[model samples]
Target: MAGPLAGIRIIELAGIGPAPFCGMMLADHGAEVIRVERIGGRIQATDPLLRSRRSIAVDMKSPEGVALIRDLAKDADGLIEGFRPGVTERLGLGPDILLGDNPKLVYGRMTGWGQTGPYAQAAGHDINYIALSGALHGIGRKGEKPVPPVNYLGDFGGGGMMLAFGMVSALLAVKNGADGQVIDCAMTDGSALLTAMTWGFRAAGMWKDEAGTNLLDGAAHFYDSYECADGRFIAIGSIEPQFYAQLREALGLTDDPDFDAQMDAGRWPALKEKVASIIASKPRDHWCEKMGHTDICFAPVLSMAEAPEHPHNAARGTFIEVAGTTQPAPAPRYGGTPTDAPTPPPQAGRHSDDLLGRCGYDEEKIADLRKAGVIA
Candidate 1:
């Protein structure tokens, strides 16, 4: 069967980082996303984020190029762009004009800050955005500086994924007789929303304001990563009583008097040191053999190179080879409408002629635009 978004069409203003990630998600699920690249743009065919879409290059600096984008967006179901608040307006392709051309379009705007705020036009990255959201403050070990999670929380999770969700929801609303709308997805706002459960915990007085002192933030003796003899790490989370019993049994720690007080917060530091010493006595493989498939919520920490090779990941087809690049497969599988394998990432302007033809431009017009350096 075709994928769920089989009939959806999107116009994506080509960009780096999270915006491309959002487009990738949409295209992976069968949206016909037409990526509008800048003329003479650099091409990286191995970029997984650029896979599963057709590309057409255009010079946004020219009036003809702006007109071309407006033409292509006239019938698009949605459009996604990542730029400063007024950048699109300066380019003369803002939401007011595009939505005028296609009233049913879902115009998704991605930014580190929302369209209207003091920092709306300020330069920032994933680290700064998460820092402002209080998410960064809660990460890292107790009494240590906050460790940025390599941009995962702010860029992909909070930014791209949030924009994708907003686009889909707005599209659904448009389908249900609602007018098209703009989704101002800010990484700061999205990252803040990601801390919803933590907020609840704080409100309930079950969490600490200090980093790494919370129940799930590596302060608990029963939930943290420990290094083995070979210097590899294994994560353990035996939160419930039954699981903690299983963990103790697996580690032969049931008779240890120190482990008797499982939830004693005052004893956590001492107990954690003891658990670390025991775990350090053996290699990761030994623990895996004893507890991998048990209910102790145990897992060996795997690096990016090791992750795809793991048995569980292989069995689940969590990664796939595309264009000689090994990367994560499209997720949240659909049982009734399975998506096909993704197409390879394209070079800039690879589909220029085809896209122009689809937009009702004849060969003469396409050739003229190409000759004028408006498209490539």
Candidate 2:
């Protein structure tokens, strides 16, 4: 069967980072995502991360180009953009225009701060956004510098994924006859939403404000990564007492007095030191063999290259080889409708003529736009 979102048409204004990632997710789940590139074309070649979308190059500054996108929006289910606020409005492709042309269109806007906040127009990156959301403050060792979480927290997880979800939800609402609305998805807002449980913990006095001083944030000896003798790392998440006991028995750490005071915040540092020393005595593979699939919640910290080859991931088909690159497969599997990898990312303006034709532009008009430099 076709994927769940098959037949849905989405227009994606080409952008870096989260916006493209969100488009990729939509296309992966079977939306026909048409990426609108700038006239000169996208800067990068087709890569695994940007796979599965069609491209149509257009000069949005030109009146004809703006009209072309407006025409496409008239028939599109959604439009996603990552331009700073007012950028799209200046280009004449803002939500008001698109929604005026098609009230059912779901206009999804993504940014680091938000559409209208104190920092909305300020320059920032993942770290800045997550920092303001209280995520970065809780992410590192007590006295060590806060480390960037590889852009996972803000960019992909909070930004792109949240935009995709908002667009989908908005589409659903419009389909049910609700008026189309703009979804302003800020990485800061989404990251804060992601910390809902942590906020609860803080309010209940279960979580402290300090970094690396909480149960799940490397404050517990039983819930952290340990570097083994070979320099490879293994992660442990033995949160429950029973799981902790299993972890202790598996690692022969039951006799250590430090392990006994599992929840004593004052003793965590010492316990962590002892656990680290014990773990460093063996290689990561040894720990994997000891507690691979048990309730101890243990696994070797596999690198990107090693992850695809992992037995569990391989058995579950969680990764796939595409265009000579191993990338994650479409996720959250559907029982009945199987989702497949889409065609490789297209060259810029590759589908300009075809897409224009689909939007009711005659051959003559398409040729005219190309000659006028409105459509590449």
Candidate 3:
């Protein structure tokens, strides 16, 4: 607990995917994030997203467990949940009740379609969410069906990160003497927000609505990934004039008259074919050796196993070992107040007694709750 948010406390009602990711983000920055899990939830030790949390398990089906959450929230600066809109309210632990208990609490609600949209109550995943936001539509190769970018777009980037930002912003507002408020963060909304720059380009006619037809969407010959002789890929992003010149020089295309019209979109298909043929003539390492240090905006495609071991990543300490697993380190370094190394993921209910005791429940009461099967 050594970061800018050192003193902040958050109670996370245990969920999956983005909710845990949000909790990890807050905990990484030194917020005290207590994750409340079900009485016997499985623990995922190697999941980096669950690291740095103090786990307390409770059977929220019982009145005692619901009351425990409310009690915990009374002293918490924020609470994040990823249930459907009315789920928490049904549990009697919704924002209305929590904020009543603690007027300064920031209640963050994470969802897919939003709290009040037509699709709010519908079931969906990252692909569906991004699809609704016009994000997934613009993603894929030309003349191909849209390809999902795993779950990064909707789950992590849009959903979890947006909720984390909203939580911090609301917590700061509470510190400034403002009353607490509920944040309704939806993945659909967040994904659209992430595409703001793209929307601007479209509005200005600088972007085409078709997938893979825009400047930054893999249509340009100078900004795409190419296969090497060894079947590996190298990504190039020499968009700017000077960088394109550098790319031409590095690829020995400077003397090729066909490569002169860098911005001619009509010529991109043929130029891309030419570039692909040249890049495929060499191995990935050959291109890496030739242009890795230049301003060509080039990089060899790396797998998850290779990324952490790369010299640049190792030199920057971009990844770390936790619980005998290699994972990304806490990011956006704070020079003045650095964050501590992450603790290992905890077993469900590992800190149940400890957290309840801090909430003023005596050891006997905690034991009673356990005996009654309210807490585990």
Candidate 4:
């Protein structure tokens, strides 16, 4: 089988960041995603998000190019774009135009802000979007400014993933005889949704509004990362009483009264210092060996380079080699529709000739368009 979405096709308006990520996810699951690029553009092969798709390059500003995109989108199951709200419409490739040709097309729009918000047309990035959504405020230590989580929260985790989900849902609806509709996916909205659990905790009085003071935040001694002797670190999550007992026993602190009040906020700083000192006395690997098999809830902190090689990750094939690049494998493994290994990102315009041919443009016409600077 060609994975779960074998027959599905997606038309991706080439863009940086989240929009490409959504296309990658769809293509990874066996959807035929055609990425439209600028005539002279080249794929950044190092960008794993651009993987698993064919690319067709055209001068999107040209009428012929816009017409080409509309024709391709006419039969596509979904179309994803990340330009600002009115950009596609200006190019005449907006939902109204494309969906008119393909009545069952799912048009997914990605933006940091929604189409008609106060800041809708304002320029922004992942940091700005998440900051507005209240997700960034809960990320850092209490005394420090909120450190961005490397753009994961707003871009891929929220925006791209949300668009992917919207596309799949809309396609499913189309399969069930429903007409396609536009999906307005804003990173801000998705980022706020990502904080649903935090909202619940705050409402129930189980969580503090501050960053570092909450149960899962870095302030909790039992659920934080501790630096070890060699400057490496380990994470701890001995949250339950039984697990906390195992932690205390592992550190030979079972009889210590200072740690007796596990939930007392006042004792946390002192307890955290003690735990840090203990962890610092040993190297991360030593502690990993000591508590690796126990219920102390431990894991040695690993960088990206070390993660794929970890025993657990290797055993599960969580990462795979793609075109000589070690990248994450397809996720949420399917029992009956196992996804195929992903193809490397294609060079821009790599499939232009074939794609145009498939779109009903003959060889002479394709050659003429390329010569006229409409395609590459």
Query: Residue 286 of model 2: what lDDT?
Result: 87
* Model 3 misplaced regions, further than 4 Å: none
In candidate 4, list every pair of residues with a backbone clash: none
* Per-prediction TM-score to the true structure, in the order listed: 0.99, 0.97, 0.99, 0.98
Which residue pairs in candidate 1 have backbone atoms (N, alpha carbon, C) closer than 3 angstroms, thus clashing? none
The TM-score measured for candidate 4 stands at 0.98
The candidate with the higher TM-score, 3 or 4, is 3
Residues 49-93, candidate 4, lDDT per residue (tens digit)?
988898999899999999999888987889999999999999999
By summed lDDT, the worst window of 10 consecutive residues in model 1 runs over 1-10
Q: For each of the candidates, give the backbone clash count.
A: 0, 0, 0, 0
Residue pairs in candidate 3 whose N, alpha carbon or C atoms collide under 3 angstroms? none
- Candidate 2 structure lDDT: 0.88
* Cα lDDT of model 1 by residue, 1-376, tens digit: 1489999999999888989999999998989989999988976878999999888999998999999999999979999999989899999999999999999989999999889889998999999999999999999999999999998999999999999999999999999999999999999999999999999999998999888887899999899999999999999999999999998888788999888888889999998998899899999999999999999999999999999999999999999999899999998899988998988888889999998898899999999999999999
Error of 4 at 357 (Å): 1.5
User: Model 4: residues >4 Å from true position, as ranges?
Assistant: none
lDDT of each: 0.93, 0.88, 0.94, 0.92
RMSD of each: 0.9, 1.4, 0.7, 1.1
Q: What stretches of model 2 exceed 4 Å from their correct place? A: none
